[model samples]
Target: MAQQDRAVQTRERIVTGAATAFYRVGYADASIATIAETAGVTKGALYFHFSSKEEIARAVIDEQHRRVFESAAEILQATASPAETMMLMCADLAEWLVSDVVVRAGIRLTTGGAIFDPPTRAPYDDWLATFEDLVGRAVAAGELRQGTDPARLAHFIIPSFTGVQLLSDVLTNMDDLKVRVGELWDVLLAAFAEPTRLDELLALRFRIFGPAS
Candidate 1:
């Protein structure tokens, strides 16, 4: 049992180290030797856990997706109001992207498709489905304006958020991501939310991002 636990810890260390390297240098520049050195493990140990850099990158992506879904589940359990849930979900992800190395690296790799052979779109598809479900629920609840297309809204929101984060990363190293995302919600809620629910929906922005400076 102890040996298994140690092995798991070693594997986690390697993944974390790889994520940090990838986040700093991107997939094309990150090397296995550097990752192994950062993890404080020999190359042989890294190989024992992960056969290749792509495998490590894939693991990081999978872990990031898992965290996102976990956040979604928590939001769903806490609130039935889809607008509130969506805002909160975005807030949670923005926070993660700023603070979590794995999330930063995974998203960078997912969007930098030239780095990956076969170019997986699973992360985007999963997020799109999640946003679609949330928007559909909002429309059903009359929180969204009439004639709002859930699919269209989902597609827009996902890419917009992605762009916002990418810009934040480049401009401020994500120090301002939470603020940028709040600004995005300000625009989106004003446009899409029902007039009666606009104030309530907009209020969630403050809760997630806190009072703006």
Candidate 2:
């Protein structure tokens, strides 16, 4: 039992260390020896827990996906008006990308050609599929526009966000992101709102994103 606990600790240490290294150096530059040094373990210990640097990179990406989904689900499940919910969800998504080191690195690696190997793309694609499903659910529930093609929208939005995040990576200040997203969300909702809501749409935009005037 004691041995098992120590083993678990060692594995967790490796995971955390690898995540940090990947964030700092990127997947291409990160190495198992560096990870082992960061984790305060030998190369053999890293191999004992993870077979290769690629495996460790996959683990890092998977962990980022898990954390992202968990946070997104929590926000989606909360009780709120559809507009409010959508805003919160987008804001939370941005915050997660900007705040989480592993998530930021994983996003860059998956989208920026850091790890283009077939094995890596599969897991990355799976993550995008999961994201699309969540967006589809939000659309079905009327939180987003029903006419919105979730997969297509996701392809566009995800990459746009990836670009924005990469830009945000250099900016540090989040106010610009928040303001720009607020404007864009207003535009998206205007295009997608049901016809009847058109009468009050401008007001709704004001409520959701603040006064245009």
Candidate 3:
């Protein structure tokens, strides 16, 4: 049992170390030596867990998607309002990207042309489905204006958010991501929220983003 646990820990260390290297440098630039050093493992240990940088990159991407869904599920369980839940989820993810090296690596890998056989779109489609369900709930609750197409709105929001996140990463290393998310929500709420509840939703936004927002 102890040996198994140690093996698991070593594998995780390699994955995490590789993630930090990938986050700091593009996949093309990150080297096995850097990953081994960052992970505090020998090259042999890393090779035991992963055959190549490509395998490690794929692991990081899988971990990122897992974390994204896990965090959203936790928030959904805690928040009754779907609109508020969506905002909170985005805020959490923005902060996560800032602090979590593994998550950051995954985002970079996806954007930087790292190819995986199963493809990355499958996870994105699941995410879109989650967002669409939330939007559908918000529409049903009358938080959004009538005639709002939940599917279309969800599809739009996800890609718009991807652009916002990617641009923030490029321009600010995601230092401004939380604020950018607030901005995105501001426009989204203005466009789709029911007139009677727009003010209330905006107030929620301010509370979430702070009065400075």
Which predicted model would earn the best lDDT?
A: 1
- Candidate 3 C-alpha lDDT tens digits along 35-123: 99999999998998899888898888888878877988899899459889888888888878888888888877776654555556756
Candidate 1: C-alpha RMSD after superposition: 1.5
RMSD (Cα, Å) for all candidates, in order, is: 1.5, 4.1, 1.7
Q: After superposition, how far is residue 141 of candidate 1 from its true place, in Å?
A: 0.9
Compared with the true structure, all predictions reach lDDT values of: 0.87, 0.67, 0.85
Ranking by TM-score: 1, 3, 2
Clashes in each model (backbone N, CA, C under 3 Å)? 0, 0, 0
lDDT: the better of candidates 1 and 3: 1
| Clashing residue pairs found in predicted model 3 | none
What range of 10 consecutive residues in model 3 has the weakest lDDT sum?
111-120
Which has the better TM-score: candidate 1, or candidate 3? 1
Decide which is better by lDDT, 2 or 3. Answer: 3
Q: List runs of model 1 lying over 4 Å from the truth.
A: 211-213
* TM-scores for the candidates: 0.94, 0.73, 0.93
**Which of 1 and 2 is ahead in TM-score?**
1
